[model samples]
Target: MSIIVRDFQPADAEAAAETKRAAIPYLVLTPELVAWQVTHAPGNQRHRLLVAEVDGQVVGSASTGIFAESSKPGQAFVNLSVAPDARGRGAGTALLTTAEGYLTGLGASTAYAWVLDDEASTGFAQRHGYQRSRSSYFSRLDLAAIALPSLPPLPEGARLRTAADFADDPRPLYDLDVEAAADEPGDVDSDAMNYEDWLALYWHRPDLDRDLTSVVVMDGMAVAFSVAQTDRRGRYWSGMTGTRRAYRNRGLAKQAKADSLRRARLAGCSEAFTGNDAENAPMLAINGWFGYQVAAREWRYLRNLTD
Candidate 1:
């Protein structure tokens, strides 16, 4: 079977989404999200989604781009995934080769990819000359079967709301996300404060579950929020959970996450997943308290493009 890599076409969206979901079950993804990403990826990001086809069927995909918002310039990313049944074929290598060339052409000096902590997966990266760096864990909880903790009563002057409550103006949410994103421990820091950009990519994202997303309101402002996303199958994921700097040290992030998870369970979600940097002790503690256990680990692998 000949494996060929090519740019994503509209007709390939569903197959690409399916390939990704099959390869990485923890992520919340859909065809619409794939299409939107191809269209609206920031100009500087040099984003390109590639698919690998074997005998006219798509079996693998890669999301490649320059990390435009990272504080460190010249950093790029390429994450490739192949359907389990399609794994031993050369699709993964084909996809990675195409992605690396694309990012290098866009002036990226360093390329990074997340490698699953498995023998075969790690071996692939090592063979490709990628060196491992920090690791992160994926955790899941039985949302429908697990008992949720009683939500602690909101402090006086504080209340709970949803992202929909800020439809008229989501600037406060944007500000909170920017602050929290910067604090997130990662090789690259993201600055996602652009309102129009956020609305187009995040607010309007097809997978974003607005109703289940919980926000803590203080003085009628969004101080802390847990962004939620769900797939067509009702699998819920915590896209992000963050609190403003002034609101840190309070249990607000935990509260928002718990509230969202409870709502997801009520809505018939069977499983919920989230990821945390190994260094993020607070978030890990919160997930552990909610019965989330480590499902898998992925390490960041980096290689200098020029080398």
Candidate 2:
């Protein structure tokens, strides 16, 4: 009957990852990634993983940290997840309270979170003084059921490549990521990530599956790509599918997705998941082309930390 919140230890990685999986089914989460978040945060920044224990069992976790790479300061984030079976035990509220206090101590002026688009979840955010902002839709594709669509033929000068092909020089891919990310819709303006930051943040992440990540190279330039992440189980996630601005409308993004997904299924990934901002009509259309169905929706919430 007792619940307590504590700092996460290295040993809590598996249980914490499992707790989050149970809370959000469509997310591509793994213990390695969970642990990496704690270990890879910038040394000078404030970051912590808070775990909720109920009768000695870990039932929820909150990832709290400052947005160190944002163009604006005082932007912090908390992503809290509690196992469905343990929801009513006050674990969620306790975790959120602790997380907010930690962010406040770090001088954060704004705290942001993504809450499930349901009455209970939204109400909880409202009660905590968080205001609704934007929403995104999570979608899933049955890689094990439907056969993947064939990759469309690329124009004569362009061809398909896997992320693995750039093992020695990934700078081109990094350029593509930056160009695409700058156009992504979000509440905070993100500072442009340098090569080293991208390496630590994305390229070197344990969950990135290079062989399954498809890239479209036109004249030796990375013009479009589909970044793939895996749990190394049966779940695969489309981390991002993006094309350079000039490359749009040519079905290159679709080609990238189809190529990446086909490879994923061949590698034994049974399901694929992705999220798109509600206003991103282009990517939404591309996902729809691949038969991805809406799995869930999450609304972004923000709270001002001061009076």
Candidate 3:
């Protein structure tokens, strides 16, 4: 069977979402979110989504874009996923070729991809000229079957709130995110510095669950938060859990995550997922404390396109 790779059409959203979910079950992907991402991407991102088809059936999907928020220049990323049954049919190769060409044309000197931490996946990346880099872990909690610890009583000057509480003014939360993101472990070090961009790319996203997003207020300041994303099918995702620098080591991040998970469980969510850089010990420990076990691991791979 011949495999064809082409730009993704609006009609392929459901199939693309299915392909992605089949490849990485813990990710928060839905048809609507996919469509929103393609139609609403920021100008700097130069985002493009592609799909691999075989005999009129879409079997793989790929997303490529410049790392607009990266401090480094000429950095781009391509993430591709092929359905298990569709592997080894040239779909992956075709998709990668299309993605790399797209990035190269956009002046990207380097391309990054995340491959599952397994022999076959690693070998594939290596064969394609990508070198292993940092790794990360995907963790999941059975919100319905596992017991979540009761949120500890707040300190004298702290209380919990939801993102909805900031509807009138989200600048405080955006500032807190920018500060917290500076310390996050990643190959690229960049802060979400632009409020308008952050509002367009994150706060107003279709998948964000404002009511379920938990925030910790210390003396009326939003010091910590756990952003939540949920699909209608009962899967909840922790988009980001962060605590400001001054509030570190105080279990405030845990409190925020716990509160968010509790809210998700009460809202009938069955499974909860989150990811962490392998070296993020504090967050890893907190996830462990929440009974979230590592379900999968992925290693970032980089290819120097300039060479």
Candidate 4:
């Protein structure tokens, strides 16, 4: 069967999401979120979601985009996923090749991808001229079954607030995210953070549950926050958890995450999932404190488009 790779259409949302779920089960993915990503992607990103099909059945997909948020130009990303049953049908190769072409067409000089820490996947990446870099871990917490840690009392001047409190203006939360993200360990350091992009990428996400997102406000300003992204299926994803730079080391991050988890559990979310860069030991320790168990690991891989 020949593989046909083409741009993803709106009707392919379900199929693409299913393929991604099969390839990365720990990821909290939904069709609506998949479609939203494609439509809401910032113009500078030059985002394209490609799908590979055999006999008219979508079996693989790739999300390729320029790194618009990075101060460094010519950087891009490509994440590929294939249905389990379609692994050996050349779908992966087709999608990867097509995605690389697409990225280069957008003037990308470098492309980064996440390859599952498995022999086949890593081998494929290496065979395609990709070099391994740092890794990231995915963890899952069974909110329905785990005993969430009892949060410590907030220190003076600190109070818990839901993200809903910022419904009128989320600029403070955006500021918190930018500061926290700067310290996040990753290959590409994002030095450019924009408010409009933030609103589109995170605030407007259909899955973001503002009521379940916890914010630690100190002196009437957001000092720490945990963003909760979930769907109707009782599953929750920790979109992000961070404490503003000046507010670090005060356990506000833990408090914010704990509050979010507690509320998520109470809301009937069965499980919670999150990802952390392997070098982010503090966040890992915090998640460990919450009894989050490691589920999977993926290695970062990079390819030089000019090579």
User: Which structure among the candidates has the greatest lDDT?
Assistant: 4
Least accurate stretch of 10 residues (summed lDDT) in model 2?
188-197
Error of 4 at 260 (Å): 0.4
Question: What would the per-residue lDDT of candidate 4 be over residues 1-307, giving only the tens digit for each residue?
Answer: 8889999899999999998999999988899999999999888888899999999999989999988779999999999989888897799999999999888888899999999999989998999999999999999998998888786699998999999999999999999899999899999987786998888888999999999999999977899999999986898999999988889999999999999989998899998999999999999999999999999999999999999
How many Å off is the CA of 83 in candidate 3?
A: 0.6
lDDT of each: 0.87, 0.90, 0.91, 0.92
lDDT (Cα, 0-100) at 172 in candidate 4:
93
How well is each residue in 218-299 modelled by candidate 2, as lDDT tens digits?
8669999999999999899998889999987888889888989998998999999999999888899888888999999999
- CA displacement after TM-score superposition, residue 121 of candidate 4 (Å): 0.8
State the lDDT of candidate 3 residue by residue for 105-140, as single tens digits.
Answer: 999999999999888778889999999999999999
Better of 1 and 3 by lDDT: 3
| TM-score for predicted model 3 compared with the true structure | 0.97
- Clashes in each model (backbone N, CA, C under 3 Å)? 0, 0, 0, 0
Q: List TM-score per model, in order.
A: 0.96, 0.96, 0.97, 0.99
Pick by TM-score: which candidate is best? Answer: 4
Candidate 3 segments exceeding 4 Å error: none
105, model 3: CA deviation in Å?
Answer: 0.9
Clash pairs of candidate 2?
none
The local distance difference test score of model 4 is: 0.92
The runs of at least 3 residues in candidate 1 whose Cα sits more than 4 Å from the true structure, single-residue gaps closed, are none
Worst 10 residues of 1 by lDDT: 192-201
